[model samples]
Target: MDMIAHNDSLQLYASDLYHYPSLKQPLAGLKSTKINLLFGHDEPNKKGVEDWTFSSDHRIFHEKKIPYIYFGVEDHKDYHKSTDTFQNINKSFYIDAVRLIIEAIKAYDSYLPIDSKD
Candidate 1:
């Protein structure tokens, strides 16, 4: 459900480059899912993805070195604008994005170990 306002676009970025392989493996099986793996220059800077620190909740996990996936739409025309309203959202794209996230969570839950200490 990340960045629901924009559309069906999803990007996966990691704080540590080494974490991507594990994060990517499960997502790879999602048929027709167009998630992109961001790295190097494509990866988020210290302030966070798109320099919008509050854009994602995964930052805490990222700081802890826990692998995570970010499901978000790339910035759009209505971003941070007065036009950024519910009516402006692409409904079909939003639905598909949510479905994709659900599938991704199911896959990760099955493969990842639960950290009871957390």
Candidate 2:
């Protein structure tokens, strides 16, 4: 979709783009899930490495050495079929997830800008 291009446009000026929610299914009431990032040594429990590795636009940013984050979740059984609908979303989880992401971003920002993290 146009979202990828929109993100690409931010590559130059934005400090970083933390990718999230390219969800195949809406994240709703699910409570057991967590946001994942590129796994790094010594942070095994906090970071997760590689999903959408071969298939997502995030790979383009990775190749370009842009500051970005890949926060992904486990795919549900509906993965990518037409059956993925708003009706199937876990509404409460979606709200909570958004809040979690916002808070995490705030925490990350408090330390340093993304481009300077490396």
Pairs with backbone N, CA or C atoms under 3 Å apart (clashes), candidate 1: none
Candidate 2, after superposition: displacement of residue 45 in Å?
Answer: 17
lDDT of each: 0.58, 0.39
Residue 111 C-alpha lDDT in model 2:
48
Estimate the Cα RMSD of every predicted model relative to the unseen true structure: 4.7, 12.0
lDDT of 1 by residue, 22-117 (tens): 666676676535545343222444445444323457667766767555555567788778888888887666666566667867988887889999
lDDT of 2 by residue, 1-118 (tens): 1111111111211112323322211223223244322221212233573234434666687677654654444455544656556555555545544655565556555644367556
TM-score of each: 0.65, 0.51
Worst ten-residue run, lDDT, model 2?
6-15
Candidate 2 backbone collisions, by pair:
28-90, 28-91, 28-93, 28-94, 29-90, 29-93, 39-48
> RMSD in Å for candidate 1, one decimal?
4.7
